[model samples]
Target: MSHLVIDIGNSRTKIAIFDDHKLVKNDVLEDLTEEKLRDYLKENSIQQSIISSVRDGIERLENVLIEQTVYIRFSAALNTNINNQYKSPETLGLDRLAGVIGAKALYPGENCLVIDLGTCITYDAIDNDNVYKGGSISPGLNMRLRAMHELTGRLPLIPLDDFDGSEGNNTGTSMLSGVVNGTFLEMAGFIEQYRAQYSELRVILCGGDANFFDTRLKNSIFAHTLKTEPDLVLIGLNEVINQQ
Candidate 1:
């Protein structure tokens, strides 16, 4: 049977079609409309649908999903085989929980660290006991750059491009180094810290910036443990669907 999963985030939305847990189609779109959902349902024999949205005002999208297929509303309370120990279960990001769920599916009983790098970078950890004690969240690459531009009078909004390495000679390059390289180093540091605590830690990277961070960290000290799973959230969302 076919299942559809959609993750609605701050900047964009991701839609994935899974054929009994095997991903069949995935797409990222800036605008999510009823027509798009209709088209997807129209093109495929989607049997069930699930959605996890971080942004509010998705009542319309929810309506469309309910209309299209046997919709399953994904949330933290869904019957997933994991222990969610977050202090504020109501406030916990479903995306974060989804990442943790994805990591659990990959590692099963082992400790897992999920670093989702998107509009904002989020770190989530689930222990070998399947207990999830939330991680940290920080500004992502573009958000950092944008903050420098909007928050400061001097820093200009610089487009993301190749980082030239050397501490950057000019203002723009310096911003690039601090924004991009800084993020890499920050992730490296997190990996280092988590690895120190959890010896059998399996690091899973996801979100829009996962590939870039994954490639950049390949030669780092934590390379052996780090894994880049771009479709992680979708996988977790699918897990939620199947578990139910």
Candidate 2:
């Protein structure tokens, strides 16, 4: 049977088609409409559907999924075998929880650190014992750049493409270096701290900026323990369907 998983995030929506446990197709779109969802359902023989959204006003999409398939509204209460110990489970981002679940699903009994680089960079950890205590969240690459421009009068917003990953000689380059390189150092520092606790920690990178961070970290000492799975949230959502 086929399953459809959708993750609605701040900037984009991710749709994945899973044939049982294997992901057969994945697509990222800026916006997802009911008509577009209908096209997917028409093209594939989807038996079940699950959605995890970070925003509101999705009732129309929900109605379509509810009418068409066995729609599962993803929330913190859904059991995916992880022992969640977050203080505010209801307030925890479903995407973050899904990332942790994705880590567990991918690594099984291994200690995993999932770093999602999207509108905001989130760090979530799941121990080998299947326990999730908490994680961290920081401004993402673009957010940092935009913040610099918005918060300060002198700074201009630097584009990610303009950054060549080098020491800055000019104002724009300096801002880019500080944001991109600084963020990398921040990530490295977090990894170091997590490694101190879990020596066998497996770092999984996902979200829009996953490839960029993967490229940077691959050149560093963390290459051996690093993994990039852009479809991680979708994978975790699929796992939820399987567990049901």
Summing lDDT over every window of 10 consecutive residues in candidate 1, give the lowest-scoring window. 159-168
- lDDT, residue 85, model 2: 96
Error of 2 at 85 (Å): 0.4
What is the per-residue lDDT of model 2 for residues 91-124, given as tens digits with 9 covering 90 to 100? 9999999998988999999999999999999999
Can you give the TM-score per candidate against the true fold? 0.96, 0.97
How high is the CA lDDT of each candidate model? Answer: 0.86, 0.92
TM-score of 2: 0.97
Q: Report lDDT (Cα) of residue 96, candidate 2.
A: 96
Clashing residue pairs, backbone N/CA/C < 3 A, model 2: none
Best by TM-score: 2
